[model samples]
Target: MTVEPSVLSAVDAGVATLTLNRPKSINALDHPMVTAMDELLRGWAAERDVNAVVLVGAGERGLCAGGDIVAIHRDASALSGSNAGDDEAAACASALFWADEYRLNADIARYPKPYIAIMDGIVMGGGVGISAHANTRVVTDRTRLAMPEVGIGFVPDVGGTHLLARVPDNLGVYAGLTATHLSGADALALGLADHFVAADDLDAFLRTVGETGPADALAKYAQEPPESAVEGRRDWIRDAFAADTVAEIIERCRAVGTEEADKTAASIAAKSPTALAVTLRSLRDEKPTLAETLQREYRVSLRSLLHPDMAEGIRAQVIDKDRTPSWRHAEHRDVPTAEVDAYFAPLPDDLELTINAAPQEDSSV
Candidate 1:
């Protein structure tokens, strides 16, 4: 059997369309996929007659579930019980992949043309990286978006800290710590998405967007979204997440003594203790630009790769399909302040985040 290309592209009616073809894995983006995407977008950026670029997934389930953690799991697992010489061999596969992926994200943000992303269904982690950064983002009622990396022993990357940092009243801290899902309206209220269109009108809307243009089609089809969950609960979120530490935040959640607040506390409790500490710190930092934020995230992510939680979290969550993860610390307060601070330490020049970074030939595996 022949394998299909992970991404398929075409130009029509003054529009360039790119369809993510990996429906089986919900278009889980991998290294080659992102590399190919960067190449395509770079060419399209200057091409004539391509007034706009549109991104869509091939299937009904969603835009994308996330990155290929199975591959990252393979790379991270190799680090366990290995010698010093084995460190690069074990870790650089996924590190190289992220280097390219984050660059692609930066490109999308700076694209000259109107980059339109229709986030019609589930968009999580890496999925959010691609679409949420676009110049224009569209969502439907079926949309289910999240950045639930803390559960998997990772701090958010792909400018996730930047985006979440922009959210009002420290709600981003709550969402990041809890690994919560946001509805279409919730996303809009938090400023992650742009317009809302009914699912029934999406087919016609796309065709019109190609034939007419984004502004006119959006004006023709976009409708008022329902009430926002985030907006309704802002006071409650602010009262808790404003605290300095995750422990105090959880205490405030319990002190509130409501169903939602109690559940929010439980969700934070379930994630890796070390991950929670790092994520909170990451969100609180003041990075003036996306590039600067991404540079700092590189340090945190590199440290996470060497930690045991990433592989173990993926093992229990995806590989074994189990719900339990054996984290390094059983409670958030058990993590040391110096250990959390070390995630921000500088790396050697070779591994620094650069303008153009790719894997070594052997890293293709």
Candidate 2:
């Protein structure tokens, strides 16, 4: 069956809500959805009737699971065996998608209005790229956030490395390397989420925003609400992820040898060695602002699509439906530091922020 495009956009009561319509795929981002969102966002930015914007998923599970890897598999299959000569062309096409998607991600990072991301379910990888950069990022009890790029033999793109760099006290490295999911309280504590509300209460809260008209009015409506009580195991995360390199991180986890640490270590070990190594080191030193980070990620992402590990990782995880990915480089030491450094190498830096410098006057549109 052919799938329709994933995004549905509408403006109501001065609020523009962009819903991810692919409930069956948990709103996985396909090429069409990416293009649709990019075009729609640019259009909405110029309209005067819109006040605020809310981004959400259509169904009960997630805002977005991630990229449609099955499609990637099909694309890859066409390049194998008798079609080996087509590999370069396929790689270029994949790069184009990365460029467009990363640009869209940068746009969200710099959105002008008081944009809010109502993260209700499993928000991982590319989903974080779209929402984590919003002005007001909200979390519900059901929200699960992670940057699981390494699992797919890809470095964190969609500005994930940039966001992870901004995270405090080495926790970003931990999250990036392990692809561990964070609870609402954990996310808020780590500064990844702004507010935490019960999932059941989310509808009423949004309805109140629709009626209130202004942000101040919405604030007053939510005022005196109970404080968020989501608490996460932060100390362990900080300790486990403190090492400067991927190898060191694994060593630290093994040193602890606790059940949790062992599990974390083993899990990370299962990912692409090159991806984890590069991601850990990159997040440690990546110093781009929101927009700059997205651009940098774009460069690295464009290069990665052609790398053997990315396709192999996707094959194991998504296409074949097997959880075990055989990474090109099985150990952190197997990835040359020089290759890791290349991911951060400067590009022409042609990318521009979609939001520019916030809305000039109230941004109610």
Candidate 3:
């Protein structure tokens, strides 16, 4: 028997359904998966028969855990090594992965048709990149969403800075820094999710949509979520994370003198100091377009790939499973402003993220 592709695509009526198929890995995205998704989406965008698109994962565990970061770690390591030929090969591979991933992210943000993402189970890092930009993001009670890049010594990329920066108040800062997991209800509260359907009802909802189309079928299933865990803490989250810098934010948390505040402070203290500082600055920039934000993120990602801390971060958190990362700086204050600023610097012309014109509308849909 022939093996199926990592990404499975099918069309019923006018709706195109794309499923991430690596169930064993919770459909963690790799280079081929990203490339396949980009190509399929581009094709479907212009196809008159494909009215809308539904994105989902194949397994019960989650939509996606994240990207194939272990592969990236290997490539980055090779790029930093003594072998010139291996370094060139690794550099090319790394460049292709990020550039294409960011382009796909931009495409989803501007997709003309109703793009619905079923955000079931764990959605983090690259998973967020794919689903968060959808026009209609549906989440089930089982959903757990986050952008936990700081823990791995990387700032949030794949246009995460764009979504985090747009959230109200300073909740984005808290989420990015603490790597807090948001429940389904909390996801809706933060405007990260558009609808909530109970986990048990998901299959029925999908069947109805496949049979009758989305707008009406989705309306039938979408229900008001329960009280959000994040909403209950909004007052303190706003107060503690309101400061301009990571250090100040921690100080504010301590001043509150509450257990939750103390926990938040400790969480921030454990992350890579350089990552925390760079992430704070990325969230603060006032970029006007998703493409612009992605371009800036591309710069940050390349810098992080070369920086010493990223490898160490991945080694401790992922490779060795030590959970004890030896970050370059001891504290957030120790990360120099100049070093943080360098991450956002402009890349060479050939390496910049190139976004084409917005996809044309398909009125026939």
Candidate 4:
């Protein structure tokens, strides 16, 4: 019996393409996958003949679902009967998984060659980490993107807050709390994707991009994105999410009194309360560099690993297949200000990532 590499790499015509291959799991990333990707990216970065790199995923379902949360559930569960939180290195596999994962995200942002991500389908969580940071990103009608950590009792990591922070107005804040699923046009309007290529045209672009180069290939096939739903409702999104607290944001969304606005309020209302509070605070950071934001995120991620909600969330959402999760806190308002602050506290023994900030922050994705 032979096993396939989780990540498949190929170089041709001065272009290298890497495909995330776990189609059955929607190419969900695990620690091994992250390591493989890091190695492939480094090797391609040094190869003079590899002019550009394109990232794609196998299977029709999506580019990648996210990290393998079921595995995280396993690790967190093992610590359920022990004291892993007090000592993070012993907490769970999640800490180690994220440590290397965050580094890969930082490197992708700083990659020397043109990094192109073909976000052809569902892109969420870790998927967003890999693709949204790319120099060139392509989205299609099938794309369904989001950073849904709040729902899983986890704060967004993998530099999600940095990317979310740049979305115009308060859309990023709105997205963080509610885990809004973004359409192709929605991603484009929010600056997450560079070009809109029909899902069908993807094959043609893939075949020619290695030789023609992404810019020219995009020029030949890109289309005007479909109208963005989020942009249409930006008036309320900006006004509601600009508030200092989640309670205020919810109230403002209710004040809008539209069907969509009501759903938005309810969506925010249903997420893990603790996750909501911390996620909002992260998004509201005055002005942190991508590296700084990531550093802060690591603190929160390790902090989250110790919390019961992390394991319970996984149990309810993934293991038990129950839609209902009894969160640590009852609601966003119940989450304490002091507790929220602790999620961002400086790590002891300098567990903070040592990556450098991005050269210049671009507000446009």
Candidate 5:
């Protein structure tokens, strides 16, 4: 019998590297992988010999697609039928997964040593959680970043609400609701990424890090990114997404009467109404700390797990391979205010998120 490691960790020249090893799945995060990473990072954070840490994916396709929602879907499906014992077991498994994953995210945000994430390819949802919190985020021409949880009948988790709330203007709302793909240039323009290195120059850039350390090496290879697709549309994004609610945003977009506005409206229409409504509220928190937002998101995640739309959305998108999802509410306005409010309510002390400490403020980045 043989066992395969989900994460590959190594140290060379005082630099520690963690590679997400499931290339075939675009390094999608499962419970074991998340637990392994959390343990490794905590150990490395306290090690005197480890000067810096680097995170990257094994394949060229992606850094990480997101959490292993397929596994979650399976667990969610087991809640019914004639097995009461299975139901209890599945519920416990699901709760532990979210609890541990959120804790790990908070740890990365407060890491004592320099943490660098080589965000080369697809970075979305849980992927964003791991890399975006790092001290140094490196993006390349191939980077494709988004937080498209609404499409799956889920609000953005893994501290996504925290990061989205901080993006300039109402662009965060636009990105969260519409699930728009941001190129490397777009990510840099939006402050979601730091350095932009061409894909071809990545190996040379990494070798330079091995020779002269990350800061100096990254500075050498970092170049101005190409013009951003998102930056050009900032005016329309601000105007259309500034509304207080998802329904109002869609109305504003329709009123604009432009091709882009119509397309934006169409995209919003396709997502889960309940998820979109909750996402809008989540991103509207008044400049919350990462811990504060994660606590709120933890509540929403558990509530959404029990919601019917989540399972239906997953079935339509993943199992059936159909783009059309049958959301619980047909329109954003159909989602009751009380239902949206329920997601924000506090959980019991046992289930609430607890960070080790406040993240150290760094203005130098």
Candidate 6:
């Protein structure tokens, strides 16, 4: 089979393994990577040689860190201008990227065949969207899972909001607000993963079950996934994060007055305050299908690029390697509802996606 430069695909024993090969950048998804993966998934659906697919990362460091935000920032910067003509052209280009990225994420969700994601390290934000909803999600000892869009002055995308909405109680809101990283064990407990095992045993487990193995045997194999230091904290997380808003959840954590809550609160307070506010609101707002939620997220992202916090957050956290962002909006309440509503504004019909199933409207999982 002809291989794409960004992705390495190999079919062995009817199990197709697609490894995200950009280890240098922790397999961060670029436009080319997204396009390549989407195209290959389409082809895989038709290939008789491939019965199952294992999505793995090339290195020990990460599965996919997130999108190539550095490239995204550079593109946005290059397109910025004072002239109306330049501004319009830039906006058009940005919108197209968002639409395509959102569509690709949707395809992964509804893709045929049993999809297994070997999430080894630093799965967050867009990474979560890529793997969270898969049939079998395997987490290793090194796994650090989170939806950290809030830190970057963005609400969760890649269907994170939709998945978060389905999680019980207000945990989704808490996760979105804090962008907290869940250990492999916690991921299983939170329904984000199927099982937990030792990182060292992952290779043997994969080989034992092989690709296209029986469902029952696969479940047994998952029971041996990697283990990490973070475990036995679910009760506290569920209790502290049970409220519907960040402020409420913070207050609950404060009420606990333990070091863990204190630490979590402090960690959250360090992120973009505006993003935390919007994330909570987004979590509590509505239930949409993966596609609809992605569309909404795209709208938020498109507007966020123009917002001061996005560039400032990236500058502090990435470009400068500093952790301080001077946000344009300091408080969530200070952000107008109209601004959030503007993100959901009707796009041109041609831009609307019709591929995925419509979302069922329900708050409860």
How would you encode candidate 4's per-residue C-alpha lDDT over 1-365 as one tens digit per residue? 89998999999998899999999999999999999998888878777777899999999999989999988877666764457653654345787788788888988888888899999888999999999989899999999999999888889889999988888899888778889999999999988889999999999988879768888899888999889999999988998999988888999999999999999999988888888888988888876877777778888887777677878888888889787988878867788889888777777665665774332322232
Error of 5 at 192 (Å): 0.9
Instruction: Give the clashing residue pairs of candidate 1, or none.
Output: none
Q: Which window of 10 residues has the lowest lDDT sum in candidate 6?
A: 356-365
Show the lowest summed lDDT stretch of 10 residues, model 3: 81-90
| Superior candidate under lDDT, 2 versus 3 | 3
Candidate 1 at residue 39, lDDT?
A: 82
Could you give candidate 1's per-residue lDDT for residues 1-365 as a string of tens digits?
99889999999987999888899999989988898888878777767667899999889988988899998888767763354332373248888888888888877877778889999888988899899989999998888989989988989988888899888888788778987888888888888999998888989999999879999889999999999887887998998998888888888999999998999998898888888899999899874577777778777877787788888888989999788999999877899999898788877766678754321112121
Error of 6 at 289 (Å): 1.6
Better of 1 and 2 by lDDT: 1
lDDT of 3 at 200: 95
How accurate locally is residue 323 in candidate 3, as Cα lDDT from 0 to 100? 90
Residue-wise lDDT of candidate 3 within 229-347, one digit each (tens)? 87887888898888988889989998889898899999998999998999999988885588999889888887777776787888898899999888889878888889998888787
Model 4: per-residue Cα lDDT at residue 58: 98
Cα lDDT for residue 105, candidate 2: 79
lDDT string for model 2 (70-169, tens) is 7655544444323333235324555556666777777787777767888889998778878888888888778888888888877887888887787776
Cα misplacement distance, residue 166 of candidate 2 (Å)? 1.3
- Looking at candidate 2, the ten consecutive residues that score lowest on lDDT are 222-231
Candidate 3 pairs with clashing backbones: none
* Model 5 segments more than 4 A misplaced: 1-3, 78-91, 357-365
Task: Give the clashing pairs for model 4.
Answer: none
Tell me, what's the RMSD of every candidate?
A: 4.9, 4.0, 2.3, 3.9, 3.5, 5.5
